[model samples]
Target: MADLKDQRHPQYMGDRQIVTDLLGTTQPSDRNLADLARLCIRYRGFQGARDIQADLLKVLAQWHLTEEQLYAKTREIHTTAKVFATHNDGRDDWA
Candidate 1:
């Protein structure tokens, strides 16, 4: 498996950087964590996007949020993010 922190998908260059920079910080603000949660849902079901998936989950854990809680946030993300809203399909059932 690729190192989650070391691998970045080209498709999400700018989006990944935003999340990565947030992760690099020791204490991300709630708003930043909300951004991470939105991004986490945004990448759901994408192939070769495990790095971002794992990274998002890792940060949630680091901040002491459960996976269930992280996923719960996905529904709101799906409702709000245009990408997730428009991309709904079998691949995005996680939300």
Candidate 2:
């Protein structure tokens, strides 16, 4: 077996695309709930998936915001920040 130092410290098991998919279907269903829960647990303390985890929790917590409120807020955080990208005229979708 490989030593601890030799082993790869993989990033958290979640990604932004999955988070967006889950957010796309925010209904209170078993699959959605499970996915969100899994994300929260997987990204408990890791900084890489911090925003991804927060987005999951925001839907799980049911904040009284409009339909696109959460997505809009998070989307505004440009791609350079490693969040996600938007294909709008003024955004960097290639980041």
Candidate 3:
């Protein structure tokens, strides 16, 4: 049988680095790294949504807006963008 350690996928290796960087750990245990890699690959769109969500919450708090309010504002912005696009010949120049 092939050795488990030898079976580490390239994507998992890349994810291991991302996991370590996000956790601020240089050398996490093999098991912990494997678990993180698996979780990132299998769920949350293959990215660390947990940490990103926390950061987004902090930004929202700093802006003094609730989650629902943020969504409402985002929708408003998109609607405005569509109007602008119509005026600009269907070109979305706003990034």
The best candidate in terms of lDDT: 1
Query: Where is model 3 more than 4 Å wrong at Cα?
Result: 1-48, 82-95
Off by over 4 Å in 1: 1-11, 70-95
In the predicted model 2, the residue pairs found to clash are none
Lowest summed-lDDT stretch of 10 residues in model 1?
84-93
Over 4 Å off, model 2 = 1-14, 63-95
How far residue 6's Cα lies from its native spot in candidate 3, in Å, is: 22
Per-model TM-score on C-alpha atoms = 0.54, 0.44, 0.36
List, residue by residue over 8-90, the lDDT tens digit for candidate 1.
45557767687688778777654565677767667766666677788887787777777577557555555666432345454
Candidate number with greatest TM-score: 1
Q: Give the range of the ten consecutive residues with the poorest summed lDDT in model 3.
A: 32-41
Cα lDDT of model 3 by residue, 48-95, tens digit = 345443543444455565656655555555555532214646643221
Residues 25-52, candidate 2, lDDT per residue (tens digit)? 7464444444455455566655455567
